[model samples]
Target: MRISVVIPAHNEEAYLPRALGAVAAQTLKPLEVIVVDNASTDRTREVAEAHGARVVLCARKGVAFARQAGLLAARGEWVAMTDADSLPTERWLERLTARAGGAVALYGPLRFYGVSPFEATLSEQGYRAFLNLMALLGRPNLAGANMMLLKEAALWVGGFPEVEAREDVLLGWRLRRLGPVRYVPEALVLTSARRLQGGWGPFLLRQVRNLLGDPRGYFGEGGERER
Candidate 1:
């Protein structure tokens, strides 16, 4: 499958290079790498261009807007969504394509970078269990940090909701209505634990709210608006 990797970055110059480097080292090279510059005053665009990623200027400055902009500019049948602070494994894309089959959306588990290998494994396992349960509930937990979807299917579903929170989950739910949304555990990604550094309590609480079908609870209005 021709895949286009999209990373929505806003003033993430320090973290963008590592993410782009991981993409460059992917065993299954993508059709294109689109970096959405979300009105950043920093050198996000230059850094992306330096890493050979085609830059898509998105002045809207919202995570959802950046994601949608990148999706619109993608020239591949599949779109691999990842965060600017995420480092996907070398075989990430390879594994995704190997098990793609007729699945409309395929997502894998993610672990933090600073955590121990054992801790990462634990995190991955926990996430996989959560994902399996969510799938049973007909709501696949598709995080933008490690999700791949058919471009056509996503567009047909009207793309990501304009909402700030749970857009990824909402898209997964919408895509699941069309066909299978599978979880590929072997395709793993390592992301920064910056969000959880504050504490797991707040992070887990927000996630719980989302899974409870309430994205508007914590992050909906004037709270952690960016991805």
Candidate 2:
């Protein structure tokens, strides 16, 4: 099956090239690369077009809306989701597809970049532990920055809700009811730690809220989904 990689970006001119470059270098080339310009005032659209990514404008201004627009515009059978500040591995798509047996949607861990060494290491270990705990509880957290889903499966569940955060997990919950949702550790991506600028105090609280499946994490801050 062909894969279409989708990126939701908002004024990510500085970081978008890395993501688009990774997509360009994927072992299994996606059928297309779509960059959803999430109401950005910068050169997001220009950068995406420069990298040969088809630009789709999401004027409503939210990750959920941007993702829904991508799901609708995607031409491939499966849609790969990643953030503007994230870099999927060279074989990220290949690995995810290889491990996908009966799973309709699956996500993997993220190794951070642009952050301290401690934060980078913590991201991997923390993700592993969280994945394990959520799997045991039957609520796999499909991160917006490192997950892949069948276009049909995602759309059938009403796409992403209009919430500010936890939209990825919400979609995962909906897909779990339809079929198995697996966590593949090998399908890793490198993400930016700009969001963690506040440090681990707020980070740990976000983790707790994530476990509780709370939608109020980034609600007041902005509509951008957690990266």
| Candidate 1 lDDT | 0.87
Specify the poorest-scoring 10-residue window by lDDT in model 2: 218-227
Count of clashing residue pairs in every prediction: 0, 0
Instruction: Write the residue-wise lDDT of candidate 2 on 1-227 in tens digits.
Output: 78989999999999999899998998999999999999999999999999999999999988988999998999999999999999999989999999778888989998878777987898888878988898898989899999999888888877786677778887887789779888898998998888778987897787777789764543444333433
Off by over 4 Å in 2: 214-227
Q: Evaluate residue 211 in candidate 2 and report its C-alpha lDDT on the 0 to 100 scale.
A: 87
Please list all clashing residue pairs in model 1, or write none if there are none.
Answer: none
TM-score of 2: 0.92
Task: Report the C-alpha lDDT of model 1 over 1-90, residue by residue, as the tens digit.
Answer: 799999999999999999999999999999999999999999999999999999999998688888899999999999999999999999
